[model samples]
Target: MKRKKWMSTLLLVLGFVLYFSVNEPESAYAMHIMEGFLPMGWAIFWWVAFIPFFVLGLRALRKITKETPELKIMLGLAGAFTFVLSALKIPSVTGSSSHPTGTGLGAVMFGPLPMSVLGSIVLLFQAVLLAHGGLTTLGANAFSMALAGPVVGYYVYRWMMNASGKQKLAIFTAAALADLSTYVVTSLQLALAFPAEQGGIAASFLKFGGIFAITQIPLAISEGLLTVLIWNWLQSYSTNELALLQRQMKGVKES
Candidate 1:
Protein backbone atom coordinates (compact mmCIF):
# COMPACT_ATOMS: atom_id res chain seq x y z
CA MET A 1 0.00 0.00 0.00
CA LYS A 2 0.99 3.55 -0.58
CA ARG A 3 2.21 5.58 2.38
CA LYS A 4 -0.84 7.84 2.29
CA LYS A 5 -3.27 4.91 2.16
CA TRP A 6 -1.56 2.92 4.92
CA MET A 7 -1.39 6.03 7.07
CA SER A 8 -5.11 6.61 6.56
CA THR A 9 -5.81 2.99 7.51
CA LEU A 10 -3.72 3.35 10.63
CA LEU A 11 -5.59 6.50 11.61
CA LEU A 12 -8.93 4.75 11.29
CA VAL A 13 -7.79 1.68 13.21
CA LEU A 14 -6.16 3.83 15.89
CA GLY A 15 -9.27 6.02 16.12
CA PHE A 16 -11.54 3.07 16.85
CA VAL A 17 -9.15 1.66 19.43
CA LEU A 18 -8.67 5.04 21.13
CA TYR A 19 -12.45 5.64 21.37
CA PHE A 20 -13.01 2.42 23.29
CA SER A 21 -9.83 2.74 25.33
CA VAL A 22 -11.00 6.18 26.50
CA ASN A 23 -14.65 5.19 26.98
CA GLU A 24 -15.83 4.48 30.50
CA PRO A 25 -16.31 0.79 31.11
CA GLU A 26 -19.84 -0.32 31.97
CA SER A 27 -18.89 -2.56 34.90
CA ALA A 28 -16.16 -2.60 37.42
CA TYR A 29 -16.16 -6.30 36.55
CA ALA A 30 -14.46 -7.43 33.32
CA MET A 31 -13.78 -10.31 30.95
CA HIS A 32 -10.60 -11.73 32.41
CA ILE A 33 -9.96 -12.69 36.03
CA MET A 34 -9.97 -9.50 38.12
CA GLU A 35 -7.30 -8.09 40.44
CA GLY A 36 -6.05 -10.55 43.05
CA PHE A 37 -8.79 -12.90 41.93
CA LEU A 38 -6.52 -15.94 41.68
CA PRO A 39 -4.75 -17.60 44.56
CA MET A 40 -1.07 -16.71 44.87
CA GLY A 41 0.02 -20.23 43.96
CA TRP A 42 -2.16 -20.34 40.86
CA ALA A 43 -1.04 -16.84 39.96
CA ILE A 44 2.59 -17.82 40.15
CA PHE A 45 1.95 -21.00 38.21
CA TRP A 46 0.26 -19.14 35.40
CA TRP A 47 2.95 -16.49 35.34
CA VAL A 48 5.59 -19.15 35.02
CA ALA A 49 3.64 -20.87 32.27
CA PHE A 50 3.29 -17.61 30.32
CA ILE A 51 6.92 -16.45 30.54
CA PRO A 52 8.51 -18.86 28.04
CA PHE A 53 5.97 -17.98 25.36
CA PHE A 54 6.43 -14.26 25.94
CA VAL A 55 10.18 -14.67 25.67
CA LEU A 56 9.90 -16.63 22.44
CA GLY A 57 7.38 -14.11 21.22
CA LEU A 58 9.79 -11.31 21.91
CA ARG A 59 12.36 -13.07 19.77
CA ALA A 60 9.79 -13.60 17.00
CA LEU A 61 8.74 -9.95 17.29
CA ARG A 62 12.31 -8.74 17.10
CA LYS A 63 12.92 -10.86 14.00
CA ILE A 64 9.85 -9.39 12.33
CA THR A 65 10.82 -5.83 13.12
CA LYS A 66 14.34 -6.35 11.89
CA GLU A 67 13.54 -8.37 8.79
CA THR A 68 10.21 -7.08 7.52
CA PRO A 69 10.35 -3.44 8.43
CA GLU A 70 7.70 -2.57 5.86
CA LEU A 71 5.00 -4.75 7.41
CA LYS A 72 4.96 -2.71 10.61
CA ILE A 73 1.86 -0.92 9.33
CA MET A 74 -0.08 -4.18 9.22
CA LEU A 75 1.33 -5.08 12.61
CA GLY A 76 -0.04 -1.87 14.04
CA LEU A 77 -3.46 -2.62 12.56
CA ALA A 78 -3.45 -6.08 14.11
CA GLY A 79 -2.55 -4.72 17.54
CA ALA A 80 -5.17 -1.98 17.26
CA PHE A 81 -7.88 -4.39 16.19
CA THR A 82 -7.10 -6.73 19.09
CA PHE A 83 -7.24 -3.82 21.54
CA VAL A 84 -10.51 -2.42 20.20
CA LEU A 85 -12.41 -5.71 20.03
CA SER A 86 -11.09 -7.29 23.20
CA ALA A 87 -11.81 -4.11 25.17
CA LEU A 88 -15.57 -4.52 24.65
CA LYS A 89 -16.45 -6.61 27.70
CA ILE A 90 -19.89 -8.03 28.33
CA PRO A 91 -20.88 -9.04 31.83
CA SER A 92 -21.59 -12.77 31.70
CA VAL A 93 -23.62 -15.19 33.79
CA THR A 94 -20.51 -16.05 35.74
CA GLY A 95 -19.04 -13.75 38.38
CA SER A 96 -16.83 -12.22 35.73
CA SER A 97 -17.51 -11.39 32.04
CA SER A 98 -16.48 -12.36 28.51
CA HIS A 99 -15.46 -10.77 25.22
CA PRO A 100 -13.87 -11.51 21.84
CA THR A 101 -10.30 -12.70 21.86
CA GLY A 102 -9.54 -10.61 18.76
CA THR A 103 -6.26 -12.42 18.12
CA GLY A 104 -7.25 -14.49 15.09
CA LEU A 105 -6.43 -11.99 12.39
CA GLY A 106 -3.02 -11.33 13.79
CA ALA A 107 -2.33 -15.01 14.14
CA VAL A 108 -3.44 -15.61 10.60
CA MET A 109 -1.21 -12.88 9.23
CA PHE A 110 1.91 -13.09 11.37
CA GLY A 111 1.47 -16.41 13.20
CA PRO A 112 0.99 -17.17 16.92
CA LEU A 113 4.40 -16.12 18.16
CA PRO A 114 3.93 -12.55 17.05
CA MET A 115 0.44 -12.44 18.54
CA SER A 116 1.75 -13.78 21.86
CA VAL A 117 3.76 -10.60 22.18
CA LEU A 118 1.10 -8.29 20.74
CA GLY A 119 -1.73 -9.74 22.79
CA SER A 120 0.29 -9.57 26.02
CA ILE A 121 0.98 -5.93 25.37
CA VAL A 122 -2.75 -5.41 24.95
CA LEU A 123 -3.44 -7.19 28.25
CA LEU A 124 -0.74 -5.23 30.06
CA PHE A 125 -2.12 -1.88 28.93
CA GLN A 126 -5.70 -2.83 29.71
CA ALA A 127 -4.75 -4.09 33.14
CA VAL A 128 -2.85 -1.00 34.18
CA LEU A 129 -5.00 1.69 32.57
CA LEU A 130 -8.49 0.32 31.94
CA ALA A 131 -8.63 -1.73 35.15
CA HIS A 132 -10.27 -4.43 33.07
CA GLY A 133 -7.78 -7.13 33.99
CA GLY A 134 -5.07 -6.83 36.63
CA LEU A 135 -1.36 -7.06 37.19
CA THR A 136 -1.73 -10.11 39.42
CA THR A 137 -3.96 -11.99 37.00
CA LEU A 138 -2.19 -10.74 33.89
CA GLY A 139 -0.39 -14.03 33.37
CA ALA A 140 -3.58 -16.07 33.52
CA ASN A 141 -5.37 -13.59 31.30
CA ALA A 142 -2.57 -13.45 28.78
CA PHE A 143 -2.17 -17.22 28.66
CA SER A 144 -5.84 -17.70 27.88
CA MET A 145 -6.41 -14.80 25.54
CA ALA A 146 -3.02 -14.31 23.92
CA LEU A 147 -1.37 -17.69 23.71
CA ALA A 148 -4.22 -20.18 23.59
CA GLY A 149 -6.54 -18.22 21.32
CA PRO A 150 -3.91 -17.31 18.78
CA VAL A 151 -2.38 -20.78 18.80
CA VAL A 152 -5.80 -22.18 17.99
CA GLY A 153 -6.50 -19.49 15.44
CA TYR A 154 -3.20 -19.89 13.65
CA TYR A 155 -3.38 -23.65 13.31
CA VAL A 156 -7.11 -23.70 12.56
CA TYR A 157 -6.75 -21.18 9.77
CA ARG A 158 -3.90 -23.15 8.25
CA TRP A 159 -5.77 -26.44 8.51
CA MET A 160 -8.98 -24.99 7.16
CA MET A 161 -7.22 -23.24 4.35
CA ASN A 162 -5.49 -26.44 3.33
CA ALA A 163 -8.55 -28.64 3.62
CA SER A 164 -11.11 -26.39 1.96
CA GLY A 165 -9.06 -23.78 0.11
CA LYS A 166 -11.74 -21.26 1.06
CA GLN A 167 -10.27 -18.15 2.58
CA LYS A 168 -13.42 -16.66 4.04
CA LEU A 169 -14.61 -19.90 5.59
CA ALA A 170 -11.19 -20.50 7.10
CA ILE A 171 -11.03 -16.98 8.48
CA PHE A 172 -14.50 -17.16 10.02
CA THR A 173 -14.04 -20.53 11.61
CA ALA A 174 -10.58 -19.73 12.93
CA ALA A 175 -11.63 -16.38 14.34
CA ALA A 176 -14.77 -17.75 15.97
CA LEU A 177 -12.98 -20.72 17.47
CA ALA A 178 -10.20 -18.46 18.70
CA ASP A 179 -12.72 -16.38 20.66
CA LEU A 180 -14.34 -19.47 22.16
CA SER A 181 -11.01 -21.04 23.05
CA THR A 182 -10.10 -18.09 25.23
CA TYR A 183 -13.19 -18.63 27.36
CA VAL A 184 -12.51 -22.36 27.48
CA VAL A 185 -9.06 -21.72 28.94
CA THR A 186 -10.38 -19.06 31.29
CA SER A 187 -13.02 -21.46 32.56
CA LEU A 188 -10.35 -24.04 33.14
CA GLN A 189 -8.23 -21.52 35.03
CA LEU A 190 -11.14 -20.53 37.22
CA ALA A 191 -12.13 -24.14 37.77
CA LEU A 192 -8.69 -25.15 38.90
CA ALA A 193 -8.55 -22.23 41.31
CA PHE A 194 -12.00 -22.73 42.85
CA PRO A 195 -13.24 -26.27 42.57
CA ALA A 196 -16.79 -27.20 43.48
CA GLU A 197 -17.27 -28.97 46.80
CA GLN A 198 -19.59 -31.54 45.29
CA GLY A 199 -17.76 -32.59 42.11
CA GLY A 200 -14.36 -30.94 42.33
CA ILE A 201 -12.54 -29.34 39.39
CA ALA A 202 -14.55 -31.14 36.75
CA ALA A 203 -17.84 -29.78 38.04
CA SER A 204 -16.45 -26.32 38.49
CA PHE A 205 -15.15 -26.39 34.95
CA LEU A 206 -18.59 -27.33 33.71
CA LYS A 207 -20.20 -24.56 35.71
CA PHE A 208 -17.82 -21.86 34.53
CA GLY A 209 -17.82 -23.15 30.97
CA GLY A 210 -21.60 -23.36 30.88
CA ILE A 211 -22.07 -19.85 32.16
CA PHE A 212 -19.52 -18.47 29.71
CA ALA A 213 -21.13 -20.37 26.84
CA ILE A 214 -24.37 -18.44 27.23
CA THR A 215 -22.72 -15.15 26.29
CA GLN A 216 -19.49 -16.22 24.65
CA ILE A 217 -21.01 -18.32 21.86
CA PRO A 218 -22.79 -15.32 20.38
CA LEU A 219 -19.83 -13.03 20.97
CA ALA A 220 -17.59 -15.44 19.11
CA ILE A 221 -19.94 -15.50 16.15
CA SER A 222 -20.10 -11.71 16.08
CA GLU A 223 -16.33 -11.49 16.26
CA GLY A 224 -16.04 -13.91 13.35
CA LEU A 225 -18.21 -11.67 11.21
CA LEU A 226 -16.28 -8.58 12.20
CA THR A 227 -12.98 -10.33 11.48
CA VAL A 228 -14.18 -11.35 8.06
CA LEU A 229 -15.25 -7.81 7.33
CA ILE A 230 -11.86 -6.47 8.33
CA TRP A 231 -10.15 -9.19 6.36
CA ASN A 232 -12.12 -8.16 3.30
CA TRP A 233 -11.24 -4.55 3.93
CA LEU A 234 -7.57 -5.42 4.08
CA GLN A 235 -7.88 -7.49 0.95
CA SER A 236 -9.24 -4.44 -0.82
CA TYR A 237 -7.03 -1.69 0.54
CA SER A 238 -3.93 -3.38 1.90
CA THR A 239 -2.75 -5.57 -0.93
CA ASN A 240 0.90 -4.81 -0.38
CA GLU A 241 0.67 -5.65 3.27
CA LEU A 242 -1.19 -8.87 2.55
CA ALA A 243 1.48 -9.81 0.06
CA LEU A 244 4.09 -9.31 2.71
CA LEU A 245 2.11 -11.45 5.14
CA GLN A 246 1.93 -14.24 2.58
CA ARG A 247 5.68 -14.24 2.26
CA GLN A 248 6.10 -14.18 6.01
CA MET A 249 3.52 -16.89 6.63
CA LYS A 250 5.40 -19.39 4.52
CA GLY A 251 8.26 -19.39 7.00
CA VAL A 252 6.37 -18.58 10.24
CA LYS A 253 5.65 -22.16 11.18
CA GLU A 254 9.09 -23.49 10.37
CA SER A 255 11.34 -24.40 13.27
Candidate 2:
Protein backbone atom coordinates (compact mmCIF):
# COMPACT_ATOMS: atom_id res chain seq x y z
CA MET A 1 0.00 0.00 0.00
CA LYS A 2 2.82 2.41 0.89
CA ARG A 3 4.66 1.59 -2.31
CA LYS A 4 1.56 2.18 -4.35
CA LYS A 5 0.96 5.46 -2.66
CA TRP A 6 4.50 6.61 -3.33
CA MET A 7 4.26 5.58 -6.96
CA SER A 8 1.01 7.46 -7.38
CA THR A 9 2.55 10.51 -5.78
CA LEU A 10 5.50 10.35 -8.13
CA LEU A 11 3.18 10.19 -11.10
CA LEU A 12 1.22 13.15 -9.84
CA VAL A 13 4.39 15.19 -9.47
CA LEU A 14 5.53 14.24 -12.96
CA GLY A 15 2.19 15.23 -14.35
CA PHE A 16 2.31 18.55 -12.56
CA VAL A 17 5.74 19.33 -13.92
CA LEU A 18 4.76 18.28 -17.42
CA TYR A 19 1.67 20.43 -17.38
CA PHE A 20 3.53 23.40 -15.94
CA SER A 21 6.21 23.15 -18.58
CA VAL A 22 3.74 22.91 -21.40
CA ASN A 23 1.33 25.62 -20.36
CA GLU A 24 3.41 28.06 -18.38
CA PRO A 25 1.96 31.53 -18.80
CA GLU A 26 4.08 34.39 -20.06
CA SER A 27 2.95 36.65 -17.22
CA ALA A 28 0.64 36.10 -14.27
CA TYR A 29 -0.42 37.77 -11.05
CA ALA A 30 0.76 36.48 -7.69
CA MET A 31 -1.50 34.47 -5.43
CA HIS A 32 -4.10 35.51 -2.80
CA ILE A 33 -6.40 37.48 -5.16
CA MET A 34 -3.96 40.42 -5.35
CA GLU A 35 -4.42 43.91 -3.82
CA GLY A 36 -7.15 46.38 -4.69
CA PHE A 37 -8.61 43.79 -7.02
CA LEU A 38 -12.09 43.87 -5.52
CA PRO A 39 -14.58 46.70 -5.27
CA MET A 40 -14.91 48.71 -2.02
CA GLY A 41 -18.24 47.16 -1.07
CA TRP A 42 -17.08 43.61 -1.72
CA ALA A 43 -13.85 44.19 0.12
CA ILE A 44 -15.63 45.55 3.18
CA PHE A 45 -18.17 42.75 3.01
CA TRP A 46 -15.51 40.07 3.18
CA TRP A 47 -13.70 41.91 5.96
CA VAL A 48 -16.92 42.00 7.95
CA ALA A 49 -17.59 38.36 7.18
CA PHE A 50 -14.11 37.35 8.35
CA ILE A 51 -14.14 39.33 11.60
CA PRO A 52 -16.17 36.78 13.55
CA PHE A 53 -13.97 33.93 12.45
CA PHE A 54 -10.87 35.95 13.22
CA VAL A 55 -12.11 36.72 16.72
CA LEU A 56 -13.07 33.13 17.35
CA GLY A 57 -9.74 31.98 16.06
CA LEU A 58 -7.96 34.39 18.35
CA ARG A 59 -9.85 33.12 21.36
CA ALA A 60 -9.19 29.53 20.43
CA LEU A 61 -5.50 30.18 19.96
CA ARG A 62 -5.28 31.88 23.34
CA LYS A 63 -7.05 28.99 24.97
CA ILE A 64 -4.69 26.52 23.40
CA THR A 65 -1.67 28.48 24.51
CA LYS A 66 -2.92 28.77 28.05
CA GLU A 67 -3.97 25.14 28.25
CA THR A 68 -1.06 23.40 26.55
CA PRO A 69 1.99 25.54 26.35
CA GLU A 70 4.10 22.57 25.28
CA LEU A 71 2.38 22.57 21.93
CA LYS A 72 3.28 26.19 21.20
CA ILE A 73 6.40 25.29 19.26
CA MET A 74 4.52 22.78 17.18
CA LEU A 75 1.79 25.29 16.41
CA GLY A 76 4.37 27.92 15.50
CA LEU A 77 6.05 25.45 13.19
CA ALA A 78 2.70 24.69 11.57
CA GLY A 79 2.06 28.38 11.01
CA ALA A 80 5.49 28.88 9.53
CA PHE A 81 5.01 25.90 7.30
CA THR A 82 1.76 27.34 6.02
CA PHE A 83 3.37 30.72 5.44
CA VAL A 84 6.20 29.25 3.41
CA LEU A 85 3.95 27.00 1.36
CA SER A 86 1.53 29.78 0.50
CA ALA A 87 4.32 32.21 -0.36
CA LEU A 88 5.53 29.98 -3.15
CA LYS A 89 3.33 30.76 -6.11
CA ILE A 90 2.61 28.82 -9.25
CA PRO A 91 1.25 30.86 -12.14
CA SER A 92 -2.08 29.77 -13.56
CA VAL A 93 -3.58 30.03 -17.03
CA THR A 94 -6.10 32.47 -15.59
CA GLY A 95 -3.36 35.12 -15.58
CA SER A 96 -3.02 34.69 -11.83
CA SER A 97 -0.92 32.58 -9.48
CA SER A 98 -2.09 29.90 -7.06
CA HIS A 99 -0.36 28.16 -4.19
CA PRO A 100 -0.90 25.58 -1.51
CA THR A 101 -2.82 26.66 1.60
CA GLY A 102 -1.14 24.21 3.99
CA THR A 103 -4.29 24.43 6.10
CA GLY A 104 -5.50 20.84 6.15
CA LEU A 105 -2.89 19.47 8.48
CA GLY A 106 -3.16 22.47 10.76
CA ALA A 107 -6.96 22.32 10.77
CA VAL A 108 -6.92 18.61 11.52
CA MET A 109 -4.34 19.07 14.24
CA PHE A 110 -5.39 22.31 15.96
CA GLY A 111 -9.01 22.55 14.76
CA PRO A 112 -10.35 24.85 12.09
CA LEU A 113 -10.77 27.98 14.19
CA PRO A 114 -7.15 28.05 15.28
CA MET A 115 -6.04 27.37 11.75
CA SER A 116 -8.08 30.42 10.80
CA VAL A 117 -5.88 32.59 13.00
CA LEU A 118 -2.70 31.07 11.68
CA GLY A 119 -3.84 31.43 8.09
CA SER A 120 -4.83 35.04 8.62
CA ILE A 121 -1.42 35.86 9.99
CA VAL A 122 0.21 34.24 7.00
CA LEU A 123 -2.03 36.17 4.62
CA LEU A 124 -1.28 39.41 6.42
CA PHE A 125 2.45 38.87 6.22
CA GLN A 126 2.23 38.02 2.57
CA ALA A 127 0.23 41.14 1.89
CA VAL A 128 2.42 43.54 3.81
CA LEU A 129 5.96 42.20 3.65
CA LEU A 130 6.04 40.13 0.50
CA ALA A 131 3.47 42.19 -1.35
CA HIS A 132 2.13 38.93 -2.73
CA GLY A 133 -1.44 39.48 -1.61
CA GLY A 134 -3.07 42.88 -1.05
CA LEU A 135 -4.32 44.98 1.85
CA THR A 136 -7.69 45.63 0.19
CA THR A 137 -8.28 42.01 -0.76
CA LEU A 138 -6.93 40.66 2.52
CA GLY A 139 -10.41 39.98 3.78
CA ALA A 140 -11.52 38.18 0.63
CA ASN A 141 -8.28 36.26 0.43
CA ALA A 142 -8.44 35.30 4.09
CA PHE A 143 -12.07 34.32 3.80
CA SER A 144 -11.35 31.98 0.93
CA MET A 145 -7.92 30.60 1.79
CA ALA A 146 -8.03 30.69 5.57
CA LEU A 147 -11.60 30.34 6.82
CA ALA A 148 -13.32 28.39 4.06
CA GLY A 149 -10.44 26.06 3.32
CA PRO A 150 -9.80 25.14 6.94
CA VAL A 151 -13.49 24.59 7.70
CA VAL A 152 -13.94 22.28 4.73
CA GLY A 153 -10.60 20.60 5.29
CA TYR A 154 -11.26 19.92 8.96
CA TYR A 155 -14.64 18.35 8.26
CA VAL A 156 -13.24 16.33 5.39
CA TYR A 157 -10.44 15.13 7.66
CA ARG A 158 -13.00 14.07 10.25
CA TRP A 159 -15.04 12.19 7.68
CA MET A 160 -12.03 10.53 6.07
CA MET A 161 -10.43 9.67 9.39
CA ASN A 162 -13.64 7.98 10.47
CA ALA A 163 -14.17 6.17 7.17
CA SER A 164 -10.74 5.19 5.89
CA GLY A 165 -8.80 3.92 8.91
CA LYS A 166 -5.78 4.63 6.75
CA GLN A 167 -4.25 7.69 8.34
CA LYS A 168 -2.11 8.57 5.34
CA LEU A 169 -5.02 8.43 2.95
CA ALA A 170 -7.18 10.50 5.23
CA ILE A 171 -4.46 13.10 5.69
CA PHE A 172 -3.65 13.30 2.00
CA THR A 173 -7.25 13.59 0.89
CA ALA A 174 -8.07 16.18 3.51
CA ALA A 175 -5.08 18.33 2.72
CA ALA A 176 -5.53 18.13 -1.04
CA LEU A 177 -9.22 18.90 -0.88
CA ALA A 178 -8.57 21.75 1.52
CA ASP A 179 -6.22 23.34 -0.97
CA LEU A 180 -8.70 22.86 -3.78
CA SER A 181 -11.54 24.26 -1.70
CA THR A 182 -9.70 27.58 -1.34
CA TYR A 183 -9.51 27.92 -5.10
CA VAL A 184 -13.13 26.94 -5.46
CA VAL A 185 -14.18 29.61 -3.00
CA THR A 186 -11.95 32.17 -4.71
CA SER A 187 -13.54 31.29 -8.03
CA LEU A 188 -16.98 31.85 -6.59
CA GLN A 189 -15.93 35.21 -5.16
CA LEU A 190 -14.49 36.36 -8.47
CA ALA A 191 -17.51 35.08 -10.35
CA LEU A 192 -19.86 36.94 -8.07
CA ALA A 193 -17.87 40.10 -8.52
CA PHE A 194 -17.47 39.90 -12.27
CA PRO A 195 -20.21 37.79 -13.70
CA ALA A 196 -20.01 36.74 -17.29
CA GLU A 197 -22.01 38.93 -19.67
CA GLN A 198 -23.67 36.01 -21.39
CA GLY A 199 -24.22 33.33 -18.73
CA GLY A 200 -23.92 35.27 -15.47
CA ILE A 201 -22.34 34.14 -12.17
CA ALA A 202 -22.50 30.44 -12.78
CA ALA A 203 -20.74 30.71 -16.11
CA SER A 204 -18.13 33.02 -14.66
CA PHE A 205 -17.53 30.57 -11.84
CA LEU A 206 -16.96 27.79 -14.32
CA LYS A 207 -14.63 29.98 -16.28
CA PHE A 208 -12.51 30.97 -13.28
CA GLY A 209 -12.65 27.50 -11.78
CA GLY A 210 -11.60 25.87 -15.01
CA ILE A 211 -8.65 28.21 -15.37
CA PHE A 212 -7.48 27.77 -11.76
CA ALA A 213 -7.91 24.01 -11.75
CA ILE A 214 -5.20 23.64 -14.36
CA THR A 215 -2.57 24.72 -11.80
CA GLN A 216 -4.42 24.21 -8.54
CA ILE A 217 -5.21 20.54 -8.97
CA PRO A 218 -1.57 19.64 -9.18
CA LEU A 219 -0.67 21.97 -6.32
CA ALA A 220 -3.34 20.37 -4.16
CA ILE A 221 -2.03 16.90 -4.85
CA SER A 222 1.53 17.96 -4.18
CA GLU A 223 0.51 19.59 -0.92
CA GLY A 224 -1.35 16.44 0.09
CA LEU A 225 1.71 14.33 -0.46
CA LEU A 226 3.88 16.84 1.32
CA THR A 227 1.48 16.89 4.27
CA VAL A 228 1.66 13.14 4.57
CA LEU A 229 5.41 13.25 4.49
CA ILE A 230 5.48 15.92 7.14
CA TRP A 231 3.16 13.87 9.29
CA ASN A 232 5.37 10.85 8.91
CA TRP A 233 8.41 12.88 9.84
CA LEU A 234 6.67 14.25 12.90
CA GLN A 235 5.62 10.78 13.94
CA SER A 236 9.21 9.69 13.75
CA TYR A 237 10.90 12.64 15.39
CA SER A 238 8.23 14.24 17.55
CA THR A 239 6.19 11.36 18.80
CA ASN A 240 5.30 13.05 22.07
CA GLU A 241 4.16 16.21 20.31
CA LEU A 242 2.05 14.23 17.92
CA ALA A 243 0.42 12.39 20.83
CA LEU A 244 -0.39 15.68 22.51
CA LEU A 245 -1.97 16.93 19.30
CA GLN A 246 -4.04 13.77 19.01
CA ARG A 247 -5.24 14.24 22.54
CA GLN A 248 -6.22 17.83 21.77
CA MET A 249 -8.10 16.70 18.71
CA LYS A 250 -9.86 14.05 20.75
CA GLY A 251 -10.81 16.65 23.33
CA VAL A 252 -12.24 18.88 20.63
CA LYS A 253 -14.24 16.00 19.14
CA GLU A 254 -15.65 15.01 22.51
CA SER A 255 -16.61 18.54 23.47
Q: For residues 1-255, what per-residue lDDT tens digits would candidate 2 score against the true structure? A: 756766665666556445544554455577578888888889999999998999999999998899889999999988987887787777776677777788988987898899888999999998899887798898999999889998988898889888877889888988999899998999899999999999999999999889778888888988888888777767766789889889988998899
Candidate 1 C-alpha lDDT tens digits along 1-255: 566666765666565445444442466477689899899999999999999999999998889889999898888999998997888776666656677778999998888888988999999999888887899999999999999999999899999998989999899999999999998999899999999999999999998899779878987887787787788779878789898889888876565
Ten-residue region with minimum lDDT total, candidate 2: 16-25
lDDT of 2 at 103: 90
Count backbone clashes in candidate 2: 0
TM-score of each: 0.89, 0.89
Q: What local distance difference test score does each model get?
A: 0.86, 0.84
The local lDDT score (0 to 100) that residue 190 gets in candidate 2 is: 90
Question: Which pairs of residues have clashing backbones in candidate 2?
Answer: none
Model 1, position 161: C-alpha lDDT score = 90
Cα deviation of 80, candidate 1, in Å: 0.7
